[model samples]
Target: MTKAERALETRERILKAACEVIADIGFENVSMRKVAEHAGVSKALLHYHFDTREKLFAEAMTHSFAQTGTDLDGGDADVPAGVLLARIVRTMLPTDEELRQDWKLWQELWVRAQRDDAARHLAVDLYDQLHAWVGGAVERGVASGEFAPCDVAAISTLILALCDGLGIRVMLADPRVDLSTAQSTIWSAIAPSLGISPAFPET
Candidate 1:
């Protein structure tokens, strides 16, 4: 491959390694050297790509989210909006191993954001992206007449907050709150507002 391609590959490797390291251990315990070792690159090369641990952490967290492939637009037009929204809600939870790891990274960011200004900003920016995606789905549902006209922004915030609360329980292996229960609870709470059934869509 060309030099640029190689560089891009290395950068991606480092970011993936960073995500794994930070998720395995707490972010506070991770070092650039540790990430470099995990990525099978020299410390100098890691530094060349990301000058600081904070920068690396930010990018790693963003990378982890992007890996989910959750998009804001252009799903199967034939799919009902409720089904599409249900799919998006399911994706936000730690239903599988990869999502579990991604959730761990999010937990790390939550802890770091409490004290680190940069991390705080990153958290807000990431939330904004999530909000846009969820809100867009809600708007689409309304426009398609599959959902009742309501406050889209408020509904989006409520859905996200519910997911955050229930997702933590699922991640912690709370027997009372399995993935299905969490999903159903969210659907039940919001379905009335959207004029849809409380049942979680099979999709």
Candidate 2:
């Protein structure tokens, strides 16, 4: 690889190390030195890549989701719109091992969002991506006659809000909330909005 490519790889390594460190420990307990050690690099090199711990943590959140294939920026293009939507819902169930880690990382980011502008912006940006993903699927479904006419934007926002709320319940270990309940509730709630039966074959 060229020098530039090598540098990019090193930067990615540092970010992945930061994610692993934070995932292993709580975010509040993470340190740049710890991340550097985790990455097998020197503290100075870690600082060279990311000047502040907050910045590193913020970027790490993006890296973490991307690695898990849960960013949902461009889901399977070959699948039907409904199947793609169902796949998205399934990934967010938090029952899978990687997704469960994502939920824990998200919990930390959500708390940080309240006190940090950078964290808040990252959270908003991810949510917007999610909104677009759902909205695009709904539009495609309507155009293909798979769904009925409805307010696309409003339904998109509502779906996100509902998942966010229910996901929180699952994360909080609410006595009544489990992965199956969360997944089924969200699928049932959203399916009708698309003018389809409340059940879709699991992707």
Task: List lDDT for all candidates, in order.
Answer: 0.92, 0.80
Clashes of 2: 0
Among all windows of ten consecutive residues in candidate 1, which has the lowest summed lDDT? 69-78
Deviation in angstroms for 105 in model 1? 0.9
TM-scores for all predictions = 0.96, 0.89
At residue 63, give the lDDT of candidate 1. 93
Predicted candidate 2 versus true structure: per-residue lDDT over 1-203, tens digit per residue: 99999889999999878877787898999999999999999999999989998889888998876765453436455567777677677665566767777878888899999998989999999888878877887898788888888899988887777677888887778979887787778778877767787864566
Off by over 4 Å in 2: 68-76
Worst 10 residues of 2 by lDDT: 69-78
